[model samples]
Target: MKKLIQFYLFIIFSIPCFSQSFSFEWTKQLSSTYFAEYIWEIATDNDGNIYGATDGGGIQTFLDTTFDVATSASSTVLFKINDAGERKWLRHITNSENGSIAVDSNKKVYSGGWFIGSSSLPPYTLTAGAGFGNSSYYTTLDSLGNFTSATKVFSGNSFLNSIAPVICNEAGDVAYIDNREFPSGFTYIQYHTLTKKNSGGTSWTKAFTTTDVVPLYIDPANNLYIKGAYTSAITVGGTTLTNSGGQDIYVAKLDGAGIYKWVKKIGGNHDEWLQSAATDADGNLYISGYFNSDSIDLDGIKLYAELTENNSFVAKINAAGNYEWAINLDSNAYHFAMNLLVDEDGNKVLITGRYTEEMTLGTDILTVTPDQNIYVARLDLSGNILSGMQITFPLSATIYDRKLISPESMLICGTFSGSVAFGDSTYTSAGGDDGFITKINFCELPATYYADIDNDGYGTPDTFTTACNMPIGYTNNSSDCDDSNNAINPLALESCNTIDDNCDGNIDEGLIIATITPASATSFCKGESGILNANTGVGFSYQWKKNGVNISGATSSSYTATKTGNYSVLITIPGSCNDISDETSVTVYNKPNATITNIDATNDLCFDTSIKLKTGNGVGFTFQWYKGATALAGATSNIYFATTSGNYKVKTTNSFGCFKMSTPYTIIKTCKLGESDSPNLQVLIIVLVALKCQQPIQLLKIVNFGNQSL
Candidate 1:
């Protein structure tokens, strides 16, 4: 048996939010081709997959699969789809009203709602008390969309009932709020119960008194938070709070073990309603709603409502359940702050709701048509509006649920009449209001970026757009010649890939180098030159280098090597593509010395006498003796004997085939006078052949001293 508890009721208000630069990635429409379906709520799993719970159902087609929903007015439809809008499965819960759906960290989904008479969820069924009796039931399914189990929580004699969304934390703990009724004496008494099912399948129930208390959220630590409006005094966990105005807003917390933590009440002299609440990773709480009170007190801080109609307000509370700050959004007409979500770090908060006419927050004004306007705004934890945007529909539209996939991305679901634009495409409803889910990205002052399809840091200018901060698969450098290949970028190195790896116009230009003409080492004698030519190609430029340094005036295909060093040529193509050929080592040797000397030391001799002459240092050399300018016959040896007088010279050629000429040597025709021939000096014919003398010639004036005749 379940224990009865008091109930607290809170009224929900609608308000407009702020504005900012918002871009939609995709939009999905859900409804029958001929019938209308209103998407009441949406939830996401850890994989970013979405689950929707709706009523007033119809059929829908996603991808290649078709889902034909039941036509019952009370039939509840539950469908699952991936983050990219690809449908997975759809289920029909017959004889049941709409419900709220949620997913745990493990992707397990839970949903709870009311059903009339006899309702069934496949193999599981629930029976009411009698005629028109309504019962609250909770059912769970695995991530694959298979029903696991169902439990009947409460049954009512009448259909008048209220239920909150089923929420689960990462630890698999689930909680929800439901109205339980029992007969006291005559009529049945209505009571609100808070039910918690732990991961281990343990269950606990607690009740609240005289107010509309709905289970708002459950944090990762399994802490449960409930919010509603209370009049006069309200008590929780032995602590009591007295209202400061007609109806005050209150939020209470319970630990995973069902122990009360604290309760916070916020109000003014007039009525106030709390529409939505959310918590950050640090357990900090942020709430938003509308207050008609001229001024509302949040802790010791005071915030005054704007305009004569209901004004929207958003506030923050620390982990200790203490108020931090509160601010009001101004609008001349009725406005209500509907939904609020905060980042885990508590740095940003997003609020979404409906507004009429115009609404302003800080310096931003969200002006919409006279009909219901949907506004979204982002604020810092300090309660300052960073940016905002407004969405308008020609007829009527409402955003029922929103989930923050990250600080920069969100998923929103709702129902709208008429047509709505998503990105560059427009989608119209099928007859009446149609359910829709859209994914939007929040960006900070976007800039144009090109698509780097190859992810090479360089992109193609052919595909570009203004989008979020350095979006994935995009870059600011648009200099890639081949966007399909990562190796072909502006900064890539030239290789043998045949294509222009460095984005240069020429393909494999520098890589194809012409080898030096004489591929092997070459040698030449001193004072001689060697001609070296490079293999030529069309449009090819050349620069010759010596000893690894560029040689002046050596820019042709052929170069003259006049000195000894390592030589190479730079073969180039236009557009800075070039390569240096392998070095050709050159060696130059000195020609053998080519001087001639007299061997016998006798240049003046009589007839029939001869002298010998030789050239200097004759190793590895070919020598030739010359008379005047004519080559002497048989003078090719390194040594020569001169029998006649004439100007004589020697020419030498080294092993390297280089030649050098020596100075001329001369032998004069002369006679040496003997003692017996000196008497008749005037008519004597002196024969001085083969004579060796210290002095060769002398005047014969001694005739009178040797004979006495003159």
Candidate 2:
């Protein structure tokens, strides 16, 4: 039997995979002659298309011709298949040792690998990438597998590019940390450096004196993470990291611009080789590798590794790069290759690898029957094998690749030999040791249901349950306006609320809920306006009314009342839940209206004679008299006297507390009395003088000078 390897497990394995969650669904194999080669990574687009990234040799299997030409790879390759396995398209990339694959939001595919350029036509000249020259290659293809951009990168300096993994973020920013072999004095030193390039051709490269750096992931935010093993001491960003003798692993976190955020090491007093790592949607990392040491330290915690063979171990680190837990899987079997994947929800982890002898997890152990058999396990975040699942295929499996189709489903691809049984289905090798793709659903979550004890069309808002399906008298709706009454569902009309009047997920909401903004009576002066605002509950419309009549065009939260009346509002809400707001009577008091009505002025009478004027009779109100526009001094009563010729008016008061002025009446002085200039007393004066004029007779008809009478 051959070995088992299944997941680069990054791309769509965004979920956390648990060891006990791996269940065999259906496996289909395409024939391939060569095995035990090439590292694989896979991803899927929004359209459910599956694409695999890895180098393959020999004959490629076809799912009845999924793609165009219908042929496998003779060299480096990118294989794609539809979600239904109805079609496929595989392209032969240049000779690449290790490669990575990704899909952008635009469905554009990117593929790259380390070591470019052969001695022939030159592998760099044949490869494709966005920014390629000679040493490395990067290529892009449209959603339909049409070639777009290609570039091969070549080195001109002393720095050498290691076969580190590459990552392409959702923004299309490509990033990697390749080992740079530079000569310092007599010997060539090995150090790692991170390089990042933007789609617009902007680039930045940062170098560190660390050894064995493997770039793992680039988040959509362009954050990069690299993992590797170290021997001695290495300094990064001026901080030196010393291993506990022998070998250890280090992980570096960097920003999109090649700026170092932090670096951490994980290992012990032996040898540890980091083959691969996968991150959940939360950025929590799950690393898969083999260590030959006796005791190793994970973060600050110490762990003991089984001493017999090369034991494969998986460790988990939080987003902050702190160790959470680690487990030594298959300590008895020598590991050839392995892949790890974490579900997107970060709750489960799936590990695919090869082993011999036996597999022990917790209390459950499965022995490899006869010889070497492919092993796949599922685990939880706490590193416990999930219940009900343990898979060990009969044939040899290696270079595993996995993509999570959803939170509950996963797609696995790898090369296998002979015949393998997955669940109840078995797929035989098409020809030689061929590659296979399997779909698995290993998730279990409780379903949510609403309680409907009354067997009504709706359920009570406060009651619920969890089950795989709706039970008897239970529904998926919680919008029962009344739980006790079957007539009161979401379709019921809202009425007066002794209980829920309408089944709109609310009780007595808009009904009987007419809140007035101004809670009491108020007043407004005449010629001014008053505002009345009604508080209608949510999702309610308002119509304002004056007295008993609805005011035209007065539909809103508040109404501007131009006239005096009892103001109220009617709120009409959806579901026929309506209410009439409280009444707010606005007393519009009128200003004083004063009119000068009965002005009894003795104006056109005797000249020099004072005239008495009286105001017109009116209700209880004070009055004043005025001469023209100015009020007469001390003439604050209902009557006034005019002693001189002038235009005058009197003001009267009414019950409305208003003042009114009458029309003005003018008085004039006609003439002044004067003594006659020459009193010509005729003879009667002499005789009357003696007689003393006692008879009062006197001179009648005395003639004065001119025509003046005396």
**Over 4 Å off, model 1:** 1-19, 56-58, 62-64, 72-74, 116-129, 160-163, 180-190, 231-246, 280-282, 299-301, 329-335, 344-395, 449-465, 469-710
Among all candidates shown, the one with the greatest TM-score: 1
Could you tally the backbone clashes for each prediction? 22, 61
Off by over 4 Å in 2: 1-39, 54-73, 92-99, 114-135, 155-164, 177-193, 198-202, 207-210, 275-290, 306-367, 370-388, 407-409, 416-434, 440-710
Error of 1 at 423 (Å): 3.6
TM-score of each: 0.65, 0.49
Model 1 RMSD in Å is 10.8
- The TM-score measured for candidate 1 stands at 0.65
lDDT scores for all predictions? 0.73, 0.62
Question: Where is the poorest 10-residue window by lDDT in model 2?
Answer: 1-10
Model 2 — TM-score against the truth? 0.49
lDDT for model 1: 0.73
